[model samples]
Target: MDTHEWQKSSYCQEGEACLHVAAVTTAETVHLTESADPAHSILSTTPAAFGALLRVLRDDDRG
Candidate 1:
């Protein structure tokens, strides 16, 4: 797959080695990948699933 137009979030801080995300409307899925390796490693999941996971993570981080 071509990854020329993917836009990563500016919030991806250094040293956390977090995942980067891109919107793929054709598939209705969000693409995820390591910020350190944009071309080599990628993952895809539904927006609903990703949002749920993000909510759970955010809740856990509050404590």
Candidate 2:
């Protein structure tokens, strides 16, 4: 998928800094970056790895 197609997350408000996530069209990959500094941040990982990261974040937040 074109990196340009990656839109900002709904949770991100126009006046606030946040992150964005997008799915890669050619593979089982996802891309992520900071909305405020797209050029300075990039993360590419498989769906499973991304899911695992989410779980870890959620678990960490609960603790």
Candidate 3:
């Protein structure tokens, strides 16, 4: 497994339930994981897919 410099989401609070992201540039993958999961089940996807997901989420927030 590739190690990454994970970044906590700005929306995360002071608790275990949190969102984290890491961009693996070398592999062209965007990694996502929740801080609350002890098993650390990672979700890796292409940059384009990640961007699309973010865009959809942003639009949904406004909807």
Question: Which candidate number has the best lDDT?
Answer: 3
Error of 3 at 21 (Å): 0.3
Q: Candidate 2 — what's its lDDT?
A: 0.77
Model 3 residue 16 lDDT score: 85
Worst 10 residues of 1 by lDDT: 1-10
Better of 2 and 3 by lDDT: 3
**What is the TM-score (0 to 1) of candidate 3?**
0.90
- Provide C-alpha RMSD values for all models, in order: 2.9, 2.9, 1.6
The residue pairs in collision within model 2 are none
Evaluate residue 7 in candidate 3 and report its C-alpha lDDT on the 0 to 100 scale. 94
Task: List candidate 3 segments past 4 Å from native.
Answer: none
What digit string (tens of lDDT, one per residue) describes model 2 on residues 1-63?
244567777678777477778887678888888857746577889999989998998899899
Candidate 1: which stretches are off by over 4 Å? 9-11
TM-score of predicted structure 1:
0.70
Prediction 3 global C-alpha lDDT: 0.91
lDDT over C-alpha atoms for residue 42 of model 1: 74
33-62: candidate 1 lDDT, tens digit per residue? 776664667788999998998899889889
- What lDDT does candidate 2 reach at residue 40? 53
Task: Give the TM-score of each candidate.
Answer: 0.70, 0.68, 0.90
Worst 10 residues of 2 by lDDT: 1-10
